[model samples]
Target: MEIDLAGYDGVIVSPGVPLNRHPIAAHARAAGVPVIGDIELFAQARSELPAHKVVGITGTNGKSTTTALIHHILKTAGVPTLMGGNIGLPILSRDPLPEGGVYVLELSSYQIDLTFSLDCDVAVLTNITPDHLDRYDGLEGYAASKARLFAMQSPDHVALVDFQAEADHAVLDMAPDGLGCLFLDDVPVEGQENWPALQGPHNRQNAACAIATCRILGLEDDAIEQGLRTYPGLPHRMERVAEKDGVLFVNDSKATNATATAPALAAYPLIHWILGGRPKTDDLDDCAPHFDHVVAGYTIGEAGPMFARILKDAGKTVTESGTLRQAVRDAAAAAKPGEVVMLSPACASFDQFTDYEARGEAFRAAVEAL
Candidate 1:
């Protein structure tokens, strides 16, 4: 695509467009045109917009939940709020936030790589794990991509790095005068378990991060806890669907990897585990610690046979259900009272469904149909 760049000052591309490999991006660079993402554009326009605060959140997992939680907390605390970036609308596409408004953005690694000028008022890293290995040099390279969020922030801006990583600490130091970093222990959440919508240890950590972010944003104690109790969690991620005669059905289809699935596995006991799809790994070894809790393992989709072999080899009750409908049905049929029929496929849903949301909706529909 050849074009004159004199009329336009810059070009903004989506994060999915790999600038390193995409020819159009190179062409834009060749023309001496500034090429960046929506986030950068937002940053450039900030001076012209109303006075506001921005909270940028990123991680391998929990980005969606944490972003939503922060947005909810800010809203509950009576601060005008808008959400965008990775979870919702593009930042540039939206109008400037109102005075005293806060923009809570769920940024992905790809988005962060494309964004250069977004110095968030409050920047947060949920945690870093080996993910998108195909996109970066290795684990360290991926971690560095997350670190870029802090690097773009002003020294006076607050940084909340929840996950402990010595390497991440060093990289974030690149931020102007090092970041005003905040850790989990700095926040006080006395009875984190009391929040039902946010169950499990991971959510507790997420809660702590949100609590700290809200306090930094000037939220009072009552408002923070109110938001925590009222914050409706994101769909397709540890979503509780239904319960039938004491049997619970959970749809956690967003667990596209083992790390994402571990929390769901830990959240329940006596689970009629429903898992499979296009396999990211050959086995469910990451979930070994929770095997005793899985009353039976029902496999489905492209990875059904592979998961079945692994489960059988591990001396577990394994069934190659081969389809989500069958797996849910089988699990529902086998589950006794007080047991959980959980659909937490720790693999991509592309083999059967369009995406994780579609997969989760199917799981919910199947459970409701029972």
Candidate 2:
């Protein structure tokens, strides 16, 4: 099948399409048609919509949680809001938000590549890590794409960035006028222990970003605090599924790399960790600091044997379950009171499931069957 770009002004493609290698990119280039994505279309339509603001969040991890947190806080404060771009419904397909509405978008690097002029009222870079390297030139290229979010923002607009890592600093460097000056410490997020859904250092950072953005938008402390307390967490990312015989089950299937999975391991104690899918990294060095939390590890999917050996060598008890259902059964059977059976696979889900959501659903079903 051939796609003719005879009279088309541009070719719209999914963010997952790789412009560096895809045939559509070449065809579009040959036809002198600009290759764009939904985000770009949304950007072009913003002038015709009602009065609104946009918050754009992008990072290697934690962006979904942060995006949802902001939207939840806005809704709680009685502001009209919609979350899209990466975490929710398509931006263009949805109806125009009413006046004073905020569009909180979770952006990826690929989407950023195609979006030329999305001037967010509040732009956030959660954190930059080495993931999705195949889509860009290298880690630097990926970081640059994330930085473009801040670059697109007007100087009067707020840019909230996490300057924790060297790569994050690099992202700031690439941005216009070094806008990545805001830190989590700059804003005080008190009483985090009272927030049930937000736990661990990662969530704390996410909370800081949300709090900062809300404050910039004129939300008071009381409203932000209430929103934080009542905000329910998203699925496939540290969601509590069920409990049986005093053993809790957690689904963190969205932790598709070691950096994302490390915090989940640190959040709990006596964990019967079920991990392994299509391999991302050869070694789990980022997760090494939290290895003591694992009571035992169940290896499954494409990376099972290698992960089993790695865990064994680390002096941790290892079970080569090779499948999600078997791993859940073994972990559940072995888990005792006060222990957790958590699925925080630090790899892609293509080997055994359609996506991370499917993997998380399978974890829930297996837990329910018990």
Candidate 3:
């Protein structure tokens, strides 16, 4: 790749690349070249493009499902929409949409960091949790990156944010008055028990955020409900892989953190959970609330032994399966007809596999083998 922005107006670096340490980024900055991201490019192209609205969704978790849900709802309501940016194809790679189409962009903190002026028509925050800590000062700093989605929005835009604690988050309390801001409570979440793809309490919050976005875009309640019911879930994010006899095999390899994996654990009882790769945290403390659901844990990868010890210490049964195939086999054998075999490792897959998708595929293969 070319290091310098020779004839380029700007440079958009990946979030994983720390700009502070990258020489090319520093050089670009010194050369007075704009250093932005996909979101910024999208913002620049908005005026020249067809008449359309933009919905930008960002948070620590649940952003992917929420983004897809909003797109699904809008499309179900007969509004032309495109889903991209951090989830599917790169935003800049897609052709211009027809007039009145909506572009639902799932922005990560990394992408948001590189974005400068993406004033989305609707900015949705699924809820901020402690994540990407090694990249930022702490959770507060990471949260601030997510808050930028709302910060860069226009005055007439809408903000749909979520709550974590009993009280409204002081972090989002300072949301700009110019743009309308609504929390999850403002929108009714009465009937989500029927959404097959969208399960768990975290998804309920995702659904609320999506519903609010659709409503702001002028969709009817019936249409939104239909969208939720008809939406096909994203792969590897709580995806139901297979069912043999009565036991369900769920591939949630996308749950690369405790927060992400916690919901998967809550979705089913008597689970033979397959967790552990390159562990994100020393302990799975965030998943403590759902531990009662796990009948046993099949630990694998670099964190296999570590997790085995942790589970044993907690008075839970665990086995060091050390690989996805073995973990799936053991978990399946251990699971009863009514139980679940879940591959929701609350850790990165780099230790054993190329990425989460590959890890998920391995789980799928193992499940299909049985």
Residues 292-347, candidate 2, lDDT per residue (tens digit)? 99999999998999999999999999999989999999999899999999999999
Q: Provide the global lDDT of candidate 2 against the true structure.
A: 0.89
Model 3 alpha-carbon drift over 4 Å, by segment: 1-8, 28-31, 164-177
> What TM-score number comes out for model 3?
0.89
For 53-110, candidate 3 gives per-residue lDDT tens digits of 9999887778899999998888888898999889899878888899999999999988
Residue pairs clashing, model 2? none
Best lDDT goes to which candidate?
Answer: 2
Would you estimate the TM-scores of all the predictions? 0.91, 0.88, 0.89
| Alpha carbon lDDT of each predicted model | 0.84, 0.89, 0.85
Off by over 4 Å in 1: 4-8, 167-169, 185-188
Query: What digit string (tens of lDDT, one per residue) describes model 1 on residues 1-370?
Result: 5677765778878788876678877677778887778788777888898999999999877788999999988888788999998887777677777898998999998988877889899988888877888878898888888888888888789888864654454556567785688776567677766676787778987898899999898888888999998887788888879989889888889999776788988877788999999889877778887787888999999988888887788888988898899998999999999999988888999999999999999999899888
User: Taking the candidates one at a time, how many backbone clashes does each contain?
Assistant: 0, 0, 0
lDDT rank order: 2, 3, 1
- For every candidate, C-alpha RMSD to the true structure in Å: 2.3, 2.9, 2.9
